[model samples]
Target: MPLTDLRQYIEGLRSLGEIQEIDVPVSLDLELGAITRRCYENGAPAPLFKAFSDHPSGFRILGAPAGTSRQPGLYLSRVALSLGLPPNSSGLEIAEAMAASLDLPPVPPVVVDDAPCFENTTTGDDVDLTRLPVPLLHHGDGGRYLNTWGCIVARTPDGSWTNWSIARMMLVDSRRMSGIVAAEQHVGMVAQAWADIGKPMPFALALGVEPAIPFVCGMPLPAHVNESDRLGAFLGRAIETVRCRSVDLEAPASAEILIEGYLHLDEKVAEGPMGEFAGYVPVEPSMRRPVYRVTAMSHRNNAILPVVVAGEPVEENHTAWGIPTSAQILHDLRASGIPVTASWIPLEAALHWLVVTVPRDWRRRTGIEDSAALCQRIGKEVFTTKAGAVIPKVIVLNDDVDPTNTRELVWAFATRCHPLMGHATFEHIPAAPLLAYLRTSEKVASATGKVVYNCLPPDEWGEALPIRASFRHGYPPEIVDRVKRRWHEYGFH
Candidate 1:
């Protein structure tokens, strides 16, 4: 079977030298967040702080659970390991493989009578969230966040749809939390359905689930499709769940900690103004968002709390979320008959750029006459989809330029794309409000223009294409083979 839970996944990381456990006492203020941020910047091991400065005993925090690796041929090592893939899987392979799995039949969750999380349970007046030491993930954050890396489970009142999503929640008090529930988000939609009938939405906040759980939860799956089923489909087995102590929902049996609660749609609180994943320190003001009231808390002994410290590039937002998101896009594109050879959501782009590579014979395969027309079709296929809402720009290139290779992609984009005529833009589409460049109208309406840049030849140049001037492809095969074979003999290394 696949690595089905957090402990199993952590051991896999240990074998790869992708994780580190800190014995020294760490603070929940800014110290821990700073450490995780530096890990992302330097590609250091995921820091598992074993001791806390304030709430030292009975709790542990794991930061950068799926951060990118700097080691050679292991950039996405943690992500791959978490999803039960080999440590050396490439970005394209990860995305394309997951995309193909979307075609499989969904495997619904199987409810189990007991789980590790059920070892200890507290209900009614005993539920105190502050005892867990929610981290102030950044200096600019309004309050310590409790839901940065967890999954929130909400089901439609009619029991037809259930959604699992990651939304930031700040500790409001002993039993209350403030979080975002945007109307466009699935959780928000589910809450609204309950609100129409005048009842608070019951929910369960699941933290430290199996590595693959959070990644699947973060995917922009179709509105009615269950995230648990998608996860089960990917794993080729049924996922196990245990009933929540207070709520009528069932949470993943893989969760290390689970908080049962009700989402008060009428209850709003001042939230936000935090450093986010756009690679920028926040300067914005706080806004009112929904509140979550905790009713029950359940956990195992010395339960681990996983955190993202979401900011900059290559964090969970880019790794767990971005990788799976790109997989859905690749699946959508291929399902639409677009001959995409590879698709990649680059880590350094901070979730702003989606790089897609099409076969060199795209013109012949797509049966399009010109680059502009091809770009328009690509735009129509991408921007019109649900997963494309967060994407501001897409870069389309011939498969000769690998989308996962930043150097080659940058070179091809800079050299081949015509400044004015090589792109097509669509307006009045939904966009994430966090985009730094959105105009006030766009931000308010959550609508903006999305562009697709063409990095291939403008017309069917065919045999007239210029040769690539590079070490890998510029020389004849015989000469290249000889050079590679004698590279060490020449003392170049």
Candidate 2:
């Protein structure tokens, strides 16, 4: 069964011995972020910090909430626990499970009169955010960040659409925050709607929700779809949500901390220089972004704030966002009549690379004559989708190439792609401004280009097919079977 709450998810990790409880005194300034970063990079147990004497006892910190594990058979156990799957589930299995949820009827969230998030409340002048253990995520960051692994809940003025997204938030003062709400992002779109009506946009920053919540919230689903509804459908149950004390919105009942606020329509503050998911802290100057004014804050007893120190790959940003993004692409490609057998974003690529696979007999099945033609169709379908906003590059390969295997991806990318004629670019699409390659103009216009590197075999272009020189395909079944049977004798492990 899927874990329903953050604490339950933590217990699940504990069962697998994937969680580390640290009672040692720790500093929120940079020590916490460093330890969390190492966990993500090294696959150490997720840290649960409880000895920050400077902060309120009602506050704790959990880091690397969904990071990939170094364990042999349970590399993605944390992610699987979040999605309600077995510990040994593969990356492709998780992605396909999420994609299957797209076919089910959405189950809207269930509202409760009260939840754990309502246990304690601070309103108006009492809501001092500085009292919390907000950590400095990176050395040169603009300020201490407080929302690295949280949800930003916003709805349209007409109340027809509610978008739950993940974005960074930097603390400005006790009651104010500066965060990114790029115009192309869903939160920014809704904020613009509120600006048109001459009012501040109401938002709720929900932290420490159930493990599954952030996965759907961070997904780039269609603008018409509500993540809360899709999340309920994914688990085949309605998620419990509660009304915010000061905002006209709902937050997850499982939240460890909740902050209700209004985003100023026109006001701006310099934010950023924090390390991002792609592994690099962009060298650009601090960009001015919209400001958030906190109205109320609430939390349960001994609240635990979950955080993602997103810098390198294999972190929450890569696993959580990358898995859902692959699912969305797989759904869209199949819907568009493309024969995409599998799709994946290798962890080390940091969500920049989308690896798509087609069956060997795809040419005969779809009657697609050439590699270039198929590449065009794939690009047209993928680059136009909402999830494609952050995908800077896509790689097309045969089903035999196992999209989930980064080594195979690297092998195919290096050997199969023709330098002169293997790739195509799609320009003038919505740009994800965080990418370092984007120019100032593209960022301002919210338009950029995407590329597709055709790694499909040249056999599609009328040449005789070349044989794959791998042990699985190159050798006969009898020899492979014999080798496999004697693998222990060969001392391979």
lDDT of 1 by residue, 173-275 (tens): 9899987788998999999999999999999999999888888988989889999998899988888998888989998889988999899989888988777
TM-score of each: 0.98, 0.96
Clashing pairs in 2: none
Off by over 4 Å in 1: none
The Cα error of candidate 1 at residue 303, in Å, is 0.8
Model 2, 410-450: lDDT tens per residue? Answer: 88889989887757788897757776677889877878888
After superposition, which runs of candidate 2 have C-alpha atoms over 4 Å from their true positions? 53-56, 459-465, 490-493
Local distance difference test scores for all models: 0.87, 0.87
